[model samples]
Target: MNLEVLSQHMNLISLVVLAVVVAIGFIKKINIGFFSIGAAFILGLAGQMSAKDISKGFSSSMFVTLVGVTFFFGMASQNGTLDLFSKKIVALVGKRTYLIPILMFALSAFISAIGPGHIAAGILMTTFAVYLAFELDINPMATALYAKLGANAGCASTLSMTGILAKNLSEPLGYTGFGTHLFLTTLLSGFVFTLILYIYYKGYKVKGDNPLKLSDIPAFNRDQKITVAAIVIMVVACIGFKLDTGLFAFVAAAVLILLGCADEKKAIKSIPWGTLMLICGVGVLVNVIDKLGGITLVSDFLSSHMNQSTAAPIMAATSGILSWVSSTTGVVMPTLYPICDNIVKTFGSNVSYVELISAVTATSFAAAISPLSTGGAIIMSSYSAAKETTTDEMNKMFKTLFLLSVMNVVINVIMAALGVFNLGHLFY
Candidate 1:
């Protein structure tokens, strides 16, 4: 780890800078993307890569995807469609306030499973769930946590975002036919986490007078109806036809605006520009890390310490830790899928590859609620947008999320060790 050794090992150097970037960004309140981009440049140059080659790390596709989906959902939020729609759903349970959290959890899972993916579902639903927490006298922390958990849970279907990514990655590594089991692992493990959140928040004992009544509430107006239709079309396209979610969303949003159904200014403003920069910027550094073999180094480091009994849990733990600061879909899966091959080779063929893959996907997503990740960011940003929050409050929430995320990862780790995720026989 000396300077000369680090200079020759650009991957180690990049990882050192990545660790530093996270530290400085957290302590100084600076966007990590700024530091990530700078690190990319330095690392790329030191590796003899040109500036243009380094700039290629910028993920333009992800940028457009976020912008388009957010713009569409932003319009939905601004037009009161989100509020009214969520209220209508809440009204279904009447005064049984206890069902509120459960309903939101189920709804979040279903929405994410349908195909918009966790990012789109988590952003839109976590925002609405927070708003509902305020509207209905429920705990915002529990509400947002359920939303994030549910989104992550159902997003592992082969038809969905993370699930599709898992398939593509695993297929090449000869871990085919893992989609169904991976989905089941995430869904069941996610429910376990949701149950814990429910108990901790006393969801069953929740009592509140819901002011909304289905009988009294008016139906959607002409404009709202149009917005609803637009949304339905986007959902149908994404699910039924397997269209590009962001592109379809943009098209749907544009049609709604053309029909005079949404406020152009407010819809534009509702897009989370800062969050976009954070994800895409860190994404640049992630690209650099991938190209420089930093992710591979970390994966190798973890694999070097495994044995027959310890392999599954250790792999799960490693994926969880890496996912705290990285994208589970974009980075973790691609790096770890191949490592499963190595694990099997070293430890004999008795190791369940499906179990290992499940451990990776399940535990990595368990850490998604950390403040450094998108789902947790939505919770904080949505909270601030809903009310006047102090910097101290934000910091406190950040710490709280990290703790909750650790608890979640621990739950999955125990499950991994218990062989709960071992569904290999069903498929293989």
Candidate 2:
């Protein structure tokens, strides 16, 4: 075999083996970060690389940053910030039961925009939705779906921590400053999705006679308070200091620990360490796939479709399909952001950054119905099963989510074309 051909074959073999390892790891429910790091080490050896080179991927700044931010979030949750929000949210929305979906979507959007993971937002909103459901005697599944859909929509719309995956995808295509564009489109799209969800759940009577008051919720310890305060300051610092967000998260987490508010033991105990590990592992697999030319195949396929006149509808429709299988923000933003920017620059259209970015972010609101999607699946599984509920009601609630998700996507596509509510300019 030719030397170049041999190298390509070796790389392909490594990719295949890496995929198998990841599959096995997922099956065993292993920590993804550790598994990925281990897989990288094994691949390096198989590919005749030094140990040092393989270890480099494990010590990535991104992973470290995520670890810190996650720790901080855990501490915040432990200290009662999430619980407090849930109590207040339930109380505020209880009187406006009809507007729960809209309220949930708005809150989910803001929270997802700030947090690094949509899963965190989903958990927070879902908890609150459950409380509201019990308080208002509404369907828990419907409320949960509302919260999950809202978080999914918001995740697609922002350039915040949760939207990092999308931002990473946009960078390679020369779409610098995509955050601004994504923020605007996401805001408009979120509003549209919220409206659709509200309409779908309309006329359903909820019946809670005596709900627990806010004081009934559990209290937090002092450590939790310090952690929450640190997180709030960290968020402000991300904007005020113009620091890399991951770095800010790490510093804030470290500060909280150093102040005796929380220690490494407490921090580790607070987070879903397993989930963090899994995401880290997924990140490694993604890196390896990119290195093995998988990204080229995907990128070429997308670049082939970059168009100005049809960008809105094409992206909206295509994202709806892919997002059911993956995160709309995760899959769509990387390719679409650049394509939109290139199309705008190429056409010499006067479409401002705001217009271009909002169109790109609107993709997520449309993808929330796919069972394969992270947020969608969580919503579906959480609310789909009830001990005493009829099968018919369960099916109806699910059908409602599917229809609402589609409507949200359609509305987002229209708004994207119309050039309204660019989040990128508002926050970024």
Candidate 3:
């Protein structure tokens, strides 16, 4: 075979191997990261990638971010600070138990909008939201969904990773005002989804016979007090001052350890190392795929199939589907947005650059709720950590989250097809 044909075949085989890894993980209930790392080694060797090149695929930044954030929060949980804060929030809501989910949703969105990204926000919010739900006899599944959706809502802000990526990708194509338009689209869709979840979950019917009194809530202990202050500082430093969140979290966690607020061994064990491995291992494999031209192959397929009338929905669906097992920000957006620019060039006025990018942005983020994605993984971990949730219950929750992600993709696809929330014209 010629070099070109060999390259294409290599890319195709690598993709198939990736799908198999995902399937094996799902079926065997194993950590997919181990499978992914194995696949990367095999594929990298087959594709003639050097050892150094293969090592570059591991996303150290992402690994540190996941470890640091989870460790910091784990310390908080161990110190009883998360419980104390949950009680205060619950007490503040009083007898109106229906507002709990909504509050969690809004708080998640606000947290992401300011900084910390969707997965970080989901980790922080879902942990507390699930705990609160269990305590209040609320639907933990509904609360978890709302919290994740809220993170999606605000993850398109200018300061967010998704927003920065979208801007960088679209700006070279003469697309301005991408951040505002994408943020608004995400916000509107998130609000609608939250509303539906609230009504369907019968949140309106939730009422407590006796409201929690502020006076009855126990005062914070010395450890909890220090931990809370550290958390606040971490947020301010990361969000307000634009510090590296993971590094800041690590420093804060170290301080907590030194202060005797958290058990060092337990805190170390609390980090979600499986999730980090899954993400980083997949990152390495995806880098191999890119090097083997898999991304180009997918982009070429999309370019060939796209036309004026079908472009919006096709692009949105393509992004959502691929992002199910990949990083939307790191892989999907970077690969697909350039293809969008190509489409705009090829079709001219027939394809709206703004609408296309907006659809891609919205749909890509909507799929972050998938169980395979980081945000969804965090939610699953949070639910799993709860003493009240059983193994069977966690399995059911996974199915629920997967279905929710599918529904989210369908909704965004429909919205894009119907031009429901396309704010691209404003940018024009």
TM-score (all chains, Cα) for each model: 0.77, 0.72, 0.74
In the range 1-428, model 2's lDDT, one tens digit per residue, is 57567566665665566556645643664444566666766665555667665454332554565666667776566556766765556556545456665666667766666663567778778767766676667767667766766666566433254445555545554555556456545555655665655566562354454364556655556776666577567667765665677667767767766776655676577665665555555555445544555445443554467555455555556656545544343334433454455445554554343355455456654566544456556665555433345779667756666666666667766665554544335554
Q: Using lDDT, give the best candidate's number.
A: 1
Give candidate 2's TM-score.
0.72
Q: What ranking emerges by TM-score with the best candidate at the front?
A: 1, 3, 2
lDDT scores for all predictions? Answer: 0.78, 0.57, 0.75
**Candidate 3, 1-428: lDDT as tens digits:** 68667665997887787778766766676776767778889899888889899878775665666577668877876777765765677678777777877888877887676544576677777887777777777777788878888988888776554565566556655787556777888888788777887888887886553245678999999999998899788768875786776678889989999999998788777666765676567667767877887756665677688778788999999889978876676556655776677677778888887788778878887888888787788888887788566778878878888888889899989988888656646744
Residue-level lDDT tens digits of model 1 in 1-428:
57567656987777787778766766676766666788778887777778887887666656676577778777776777766776788788898989988987888887677555688678878888888788887788788888889999988875466765666456545777676788889999889999988998899998887767888777998888888788778767875786776677788888988988899898888776765576556656766776777767765676678767788899898889978876676556655766676677667777888889899999999999999887788889988898799999999999999999999999899998888889646855
Candidates 1 and 3 compared by lDDT, better number: 1
Candidate with top TM-score is 1
lDDT, candidate 2, at 304: 63
Where's the lowest-lDDT run of ten residues in candidate 2? 326-335
Q: Pairing residues by index, what is the TM-score of model 3?
A: 0.74
